[model samples]
Target: MQLSLSDKFHSEMARLCPAPLPSVLAIMVSGGSDSLALMMLAHDWAAEMRQDPDNGPVTLIAITVDHGLRPESAAEAEGVAKIAHDLGVDHVTLQWKWDGVGNLQAAARAARYSLVQEWRRRKRPEIGAILVGHTRDDQAETFLMRLSRGSGVEGLSAMKALPLSHKAADAAGAAPVIRPILWASRADLRAALQARGMGWVDDPSNDNEDYLRVRTRKAMRDLAKIGLDVDTLTRTADHMARASVALWARAADVARDVVTEPYPGILRFDLTRLERIEEETQLRLLAHGVGCLTQAPYRPRLSSLEALAEAAYAGRGATLQGVQSFVQDDALILVRELRAVADYECPADGASAWDGRWRIKGRRLGEAVIRPLGAQSLAALELPKGLPKTAFQSYPALWAGQALVAVPYLAREGLCAPQYDPSAEFHRSILSH
Candidate 1:
């Protein structure tokens, strides 16, 4: 008995989401075959949930981002909205509205995600995860592109089913970005859409050889004549992804043993212990530590990270990715590079993060600027004992004019203190091994 496409999709969704599904699941629809198919399948899934008495009501929201780069973008968004209306699913269109001459693809992607995040924050905060239609074909294309760029295992692994976005870190949100159809092929999705009598817009940019992805896609077609087809490449990516996960688990163990944050925005690792670990594990730990401090979406370049790791292993000081590492008393202290620290102005109400390192909070921070504790700023204070003066400059403090209003880490009186969000390594318990 061959199962229907809808049945296969439902099974995949069950494997991805399982029990206790989110109250709301957002589908990212761009009027493309994959996205439209996802919207239809998501609606069907919601309908199935409604029929179950034990399951609570689940809302399906479709989000479309109009980059406004092309003339037909608005029309495409409207098309998606029409489909959503027909399916009885809530739909919202967001505009990226920007004028710039740069990498259009990267800019549009960032803008799209930013708009989606804003919508989630304001309109549907209950959205547990945002689903994108990234099929195995997309994964194969990504792997081929990354392989051409000389990427390592992590990059060659393509995309994960559930990826953690650092963009959500600043927003203080834990909503993961998921691609439930990563295991499904693009042809399968298009066939499913065809069966449902659905039409999709083929973006002109997809065939533009000016883009690397398009050239790679064309190259992949020829490569398919040989044994290197999309399925084979995607399977290779799956293997690489599994290896990457295992590496991450090992790195987590290494991080637990050697790394510790004595204070906010400061990381200390036992240099002696780190030097003894495998080189690959050392690199992963160092990259993870830097990403934790900066809350960056991606890790630093492998070449740069390797150089930094070598420096750390030799007990020599080095700086990279807005973090400075120096050996101090048998421990490598990685702190926010003061020269690179950006000044963060305090918001009127609610806490604001400073330099992606510290979250500053206070009632009397009206007209005050939050920055690192500097030599001049520290001179004015009576000073606290047993505090590492070298690392003091990286501590976040509140300033009003020339007066140091607060140095929270030092337990300065009547000042606001910043708290560290351990959400970066929040999965340490499971990965600690």
Candidate 2:
């Protein structure tokens, strides 16, 4: 198993990308066993790709993000840089100091990704994806963690090869976070590292019981006695992932037929056609609507979402995940909840986004702001022709002091405005959540 590491790496990358590109490959190496193994395998893979006359040249770059939580982090990063140098790979060390924020582990992970992505965008914009060292053990631990939280099918599903494409602003130069070693086990990776007489930095936090991941790792051995091993849990995740894909396809089909966007940030579905779909499909559509409207990273809780669905489908008003729902003339209408944006006022300076639902670009005015058109603001002006009042209350409006300057939704003729349509993005994000 140890000697087969290079073969496994080559096979996995070949399966994922049959036609290789000449772009740079940024490998995240934390001086740990898993990442060090990835670094070694990626070096060999890049060398092989370069040696091939038919294939374009491949560049391998190693990135070490020093979280600076421990005193030895900097020296460990330096060691990894030395190893990458010996292998003829370019290496960069990025320092990330925690601001004492929520969940040290989560913050560190987010910061590392952000720093590496920014570096790649500024220095190596041609790179399309960044590689990571997630293994089968990590997948099982993730499944167990989600199960502890009563996660549904989407949450329990196996992690995707490309996970960042589901986001709304993917148009930005952010590359997809790729995990090529998901097929490999942690033990095999460590054993391979030892076989090469290589030493890896072992972070003591892995044994710290304070972390849920560490605790889960400990429990895996005990659970294996009852046949609930890492392979079994990982397989369970694969099964759920299959089901998730089928459900997403069904929901996407329903959305293409019954969903329409007549106004910015508003979703109108044919009530009769929507009612004809299955309950699960309906809920999935509802989740998509709220996600598109709010641009929130996660979906609403299933129990609360079920209640909100019950009310909205019954023609009663309801709100969930910062999205409001209503029934009007045999159409189910979804809009941003007024309270969600009531106090969300940002300076009308340069180009910016509001509520993550609209992209704003207009003449910058001093002391002007972008905010929602509240009931008072809407009552003061003539409503747009054929526009529903429910959507009117949440329209993105430009204000200078107490004067209402412009409403982007109604300013289509002007050069300044925002485009919000669920019809285009609805289906792509169905399975992503």
Clashing residue pairs in all predictions, respectively, total 0, 0
lDDT per residue (tens digit) for residues 1-433 in model 1: 9876678777877777766777998888998898898888888888998888777888988999998879999999999999999999999999887778688888887887778877898888889788888888899999999999899888898687753232345435536777877777788888878888889999999989999999999999899999899989999998998898899887776677788867656678887898898888888888877777677777789999999877876778888988878877778887777776746455412356566445666656677667677777666666544334666676677777767777775745355645666544423422421
Clash pairs, candidate 1, are none
**lDDT by residue for model 2 (155-235), tens:** 899987663233435424377777889989989998988988878998999999999999988998999999999999999
Using lDDT, give the best candidate's number.
2
On TM-score, the leading prediction is: 1
Pairs of residues at least 3 apart in sequence or in different chains that clash in candidate 2: none
Candidate 2: C-alpha lDDT: 0.80
Residue 107, model 1: lDDT of: 83
lDDT of 1 at 158: 62
TM-scores of all candidate predictions against the true structure: 0.88, 0.85
